[model samples]
Target: MTWWPEARDELARLWVEDTSRQQIAEAADEIDRVLAVDPEARGEPGPEGFRRLTIRPLTVQFAVEEPDRMVIVVTVRLLTD
Candidate 1:
């Protein structure tokens, strides 16, 4: 799975710094939920056809390229800074 730099960094930080197995598991579940869906119906569409999916405490930004059969996760972030 590809992740934007921020998302990658955050996940890495969580794994190393947070150390809460439940929280990490929940986040993983959220990621799997997003990947399992037909995003067009699951998330709000954004500019250039990007989609945003909110999983409590975090928002996942992604884009789907139909022809290429790709779901590119653009970023992941908290609901608020």
Candidate 2:
């Protein structure tokens, strides 16, 4: 399976910082699943970019750049509506 070292490390660092490891792990799993199914699922115009994934109540974004892949996650702080 294709793996992203930076992404994995980022998640690990988040866990180290007392972030929800379970949540991050779950998200990573989901991301892996999607990528496995279709590496080009979130295909962007350039070699790297952010692709929003459906992960209820939270906004999960992944940035994939060659030689330095990474995933940036932004969670919803509050519900406006």
Candidate 3:
């Protein structure tokens, strides 16, 4: 599993903006749950060729590169209303 720059930035931004340690813990737990999944089972079909997982207010976008057997996290962002 690998995180793209945008995913890292978004996670950083979320941590900075939300000072509650509990919130951070929750997010971290959710992220870990997602990561622990088998790459083949991790993603649900998404637009174009991507796949996505929902973690509450955030949506984790990713792509499965079968040849490499790796999951590349494309981005993490707040869900729009």
Most accurate candidate by lDDT: 3
Against the hidden reference, what TM-scores do the models get? 0.66, 0.47, 0.73
**lDDT per model, in order?**
0.67, 0.47, 0.72
* Candidate 1 accuracy as lDDT: 0.67
Query: Candidate 2 lDDT, tens digit per residue, 1-81?
Result: 343565455556665664455765665666566655444455333323556565422234455545544433322121123
Q: Cα RMSD (Å) per model?
A: 2.9, 6.6, 2.4
Looking at model 3, which ten-residue stretch has the lowest summed lDDT? Answer: 19-28
Candidate 3 lDDT, 1-81, residue by residue in tens: 788887878777887886554655576568656766775576587887888887665678788787876777788876545
lDDT of 1 by residue, 26-65 (tens): 8657775676667667678776777887766566777776
Candidate with the larger lDDT of 1 and 2: 1
lDDT of 2: 0.47
Report the Cα lDDT for residue 28, model 1. 54
The regions of model 1 sitting more than 4 angstroms off are: 14-21
